[model samples]
Target: MTTDILTVSCPSKRGIVATISSYLASQGCSISDSSQFDDVETGTFFMRVSFISEEGKPLSEIAEGFTRIGAEWNMNFEFHDSTTRMKVILMVSRFGHCLNDILYRWKIGMLPIDIVGVVSNHFNYQHLVLSHNLPFHHIKVTKDNKAEAEAELMAIIERTQAELIVLARYMQVLSDELCRRMPGRVINIHHSFLPGFKGAKPYHQAHKRGVKLIGATAHYVTAELDEGPIIDQETIAVTHAQSADDYVSIGRDVESRTLARAIHAHIHHRVFVNGDRTIVFPASPDSYAADRVG
Candidate 1:
C-alpha cells in the first residue's frame, strides 16, 4: 500500500520498457501507473512509473538494486518516496493572486509541498505571508546593490535547504550568474501578453488591441527573462465587450490555475526538461485527491 515513484531517462533504444517493468516486478513492486515518451528528434527516452512495494522495501534498497539496470542502459534514474513533500520557497512582490492561490492550496493539503519560506523585495505582503505561520524574509533590491541582494537571497535558500523556488509574481530580473547556478529550480508565472503588450497594465493594452484571447504562462526562469522553458500555459477566450478590468480579473484566474498545475506536475516528478521544450507526463490515479474539500 506504500507508493513509490521511479523516473528514468536515457538514450533511445528498444526493450527499455520491458527492462524497467521486469526490474520492478523482480523487486516485488506493483505498477500502479506509468507514462513514457520517446523523442525521435532528440533520440532520447523518458519514463515515469508509479508503483507500490508489495514487500514494503525501502526506497534506498530499491534504488540500489536498480543500479545494474541503469548502468547497463546508461540511464539517469531516480527513486522517490511518494509521501515525502518537496520543500519550496515562494518569491513574490506586490501582486499576490498567484501567491494567495498557492497558499490556499498548501493550507488545505491540495498541494503537497513544504512552503519553507517566502522571499520578497517589498514589504507589501509581509502580514499576509506571516499569517500562514511561515517565515518571511524582506530583502530590498535596487540597481546599485543587486548582487548583494542576490547574495542575501542565496543565504536564505541555503539556510532553508529548499529544493525549488516559485516566483509567483516576483518583479525583479534575476542575474545570469544565479540562473546558471540553479538551472531548472526556479519557476515563474506571468501574463502571456508579450510582443503585443509590454509594461504595466497589460490587460488594458489587450483590451485596446481588441484581443480575443488572454493567457498566462508558467515556465522555468532562465537568464533570458521570461523566455525560460515553458512548463504549462492556459488561455481564456475574451469578448470585445469585456473591459480592461474584466480582462485583469479573468487573467488572474488563468495565471493562478496555470501556475498551480505546473507546480503540481513538478513536485510530482511528472515534468522533464527536453532541450528548449518539456515532457510532461499525465498524473497518476488519485494524484489530485486533496486531503480536505472546501
Candidate 2:
C-alpha cells in the first residue's frame, strides 16, 4: 500500500473539507486518518490527511489532479509521500543528553529522518557521533569568527540539502540573519523557566526559589531567542527534598523527551506554523511505531 500525506492551509471558508474529500475520492485514494482545525480568531484553516492509493495511482498523477482544487480554494498545500524520510541536520554543543537521545531514537527507527550530519561548536561529542557511523563536523565559534562559522554551517546545510535543522541543546546563539533565512525550519530545546530563571544554571535558580515544577520547552528558533512558536513541552514534579543536582537530572530527561517529540511532530509534517503560534495535528495511525522495540 502506498501511503501519502496531504497538508493544506488557507483562509477559512465553506466547502473546503467537502472539496478535498471529493477530490481524493476521485483520485481513488482512501482517507485513513484526517485532522483539521479552523482558527476562528485568525480565520485560517489547517488540515492534514493520510490516505492510501487504492487504485495504485502514482503520486505525481494524484498531485497533478489536485492542483485545480488547490487553485480554487487559494490554498497553500503540499503532497508528501509518507515513505520518504525528511533530511535533517543536528546541531549541538557541550550538552549531550538531547543529542544522545535523538541518536538513539534514530538508530532504533523511532525517528523517521535522514540525519545528514551533526554540527557542533565544540569537540565534546565528536567520538559519540562518529561511533554511530555518521558524519560529524566540528566548527568552533568565537566572538570574532561567529559570522565565518555560520557561513561554514550554511555551506554544510546546502551541500547536504537538509530540509530541517534540530538544535539539540546547542549552546550557541544563532545570528538574526540565519534565523531570518531559515524561518520556521530550525528547532531548539531549552529549560522552560524563562524570565523567572535567567542566565546560567536555571535549574539551580529554580531550586533556590523552591519551585515545585521543572519543565522543558521545544520551539522554533527565531531572532527573538527563545520566544519562537512552541512545538512541544513537558514538566516533572519536584519536591523540597530533592537537591539541585536531582533537578538537573530530571530536567535533562524532560528536555530530551520534549525535543524528540517536537522533532517527531516536525518530521511527520504534523506541525503547522501560523503567525506567532502553531497548530499541531495528531499523529497518523502507526506513525509512532518503531521498527524494533529496542
Candidate 3:
C-alpha cells in the first residue's frame, strides 16, 4: 500500500475533518494517523493526517486529487510522501550540550533530519562531530573579518542545500542579510524563556531577578535577535536557594530537548507559522510508549 501525509489549514468551519476523511476513504485511503487543532481565539482550523492505500497510487495522484477538496474548503493544503527528510545544519560556538542532545536523538532515530554538517568558530566539538562521520567546518569570526565569515557561512548554507539552520549555542549574532535571507527557516534555542530575561548570562539574570522559574525558548531567527516568532518554550522550577550556575546546569536539559522537539515538529511538517507565534501539533505520547511491565 502507498502511504501519503497531508497537512491543511483554513478558516474555522464545521466538518473540515469529515470532508477530508470522507474524501480519502472514498479514494481507498486508510487513515493510520491524524491530528487536529482549533484556535478559538483566531477561529482557525488546522489538521494533519497520514494514510495508506492498497492500490499503490502515486504521490502525485494523491496531491493532484486533493486540490479539488482544497478548493472546496478554501483551505491551504500540502501533501508529501513520508520518505522525505529535511536537511539541517547545526551551528555552535563552544557549547556542546544542545549539540550533543540533537546528535543523540538523531542517532537513536527519534529525530528525523539529515545532519549535513556542524559549523563552529571554535574547534571544541570538531572531534566529537567527526567521530560520528559528519562533516565539520571551522570558520573563525572576528571583528575585522566578520563579514567575510558570514559570507562563507552563507556559501556553506547554499552549498549544502540546508533547509533549516539550528543555532544550538552559536554565541554570535547573525548578519541582517543572513537573517533576512533565511527568514523563518532558522531556529535558535535561547537559554531563557525570553521577554523576561533578554541578554547574556540569562541564568544569572534569572537568579538576580529572583524569578521562580527558569525556562528556555526556541524560535525562528530574525534580525531582531531572540525576537522572532516563538515555536516552542518550556520552564522548570527554580527557587531563591539555588545559585545562577545551578540554574544554568539545570536549564541545559530543558533547553536542548525544547529546541530538538521544535526541530522535530518542523521537519515533520507538524508546525505552522502564525503571527509572532506558532502552532505545533504534537505526536501522541502514548503511541510512542513501550516496554510495559509483563
Q: How would you encode candidate 3's per-residue C-alpha lDDT over 1-294 as one tens digit per residue?
A: 544678898999999999999988877788888999898989888898878876677778878888888998899999866667678999999889999999988887777678999999999999999999999999999999999999999999899999999999999999888998998899999988857787778889889889998889999999987888888899999888999899999999999989987887777777887767788887643223211222
Candidates by TM-score, descending order: 2, 1, 3
Question: In model 2, which residue pairs have backbone atoms overlapping below 3 Å?
Answer: none
Q: Candidate 1, which segments miss by more than 4 Å at Cα?
A: 193-195, 289-294
Compared with the true structure, the alpha-carbon lDDT of candidate 1 equals 0.90
Clashes of each: 0, 0, 0
Q: Put down candidate 2 lDDT per residue, 1-294, tens digits, no spaces.
A: 867889999999999999998899988999988999999999999999988899999998999989988998999999998888899999999889999999999988999799999999999999999999999999989999999999999999999999999999888999999999999899999776455885689999999999999999899999997999999989889999999999999999999999999999998889999999999997778475422354
Which structure is stronger by lDDT: 1 or 3? 1
**In model 3, which runs have C-alpha deviations exceeding 4 angstroms?**
1-3, 40-43, 284-294
TM-score to true structure, per model: 0.97, 0.97, 0.89
Best by TM-score: 2
Instruction: Tell me the whole-model lDDT of each prediction, alpha carbons only.
Output: 0.90, 0.91, 0.85
Candidate 3 lDDT score at position 284? 42
Q: Which wins on lDDT, candidate 2 or candidate 3?
A: 2
- The 10-residue segment of model 3 with minimum total lDDT is 285-294
State, as a TM-score between 0 and 1, how close model 3 is to the true structure. 0.89
Deviation (Å) of 75 in candidate 2: 0.5
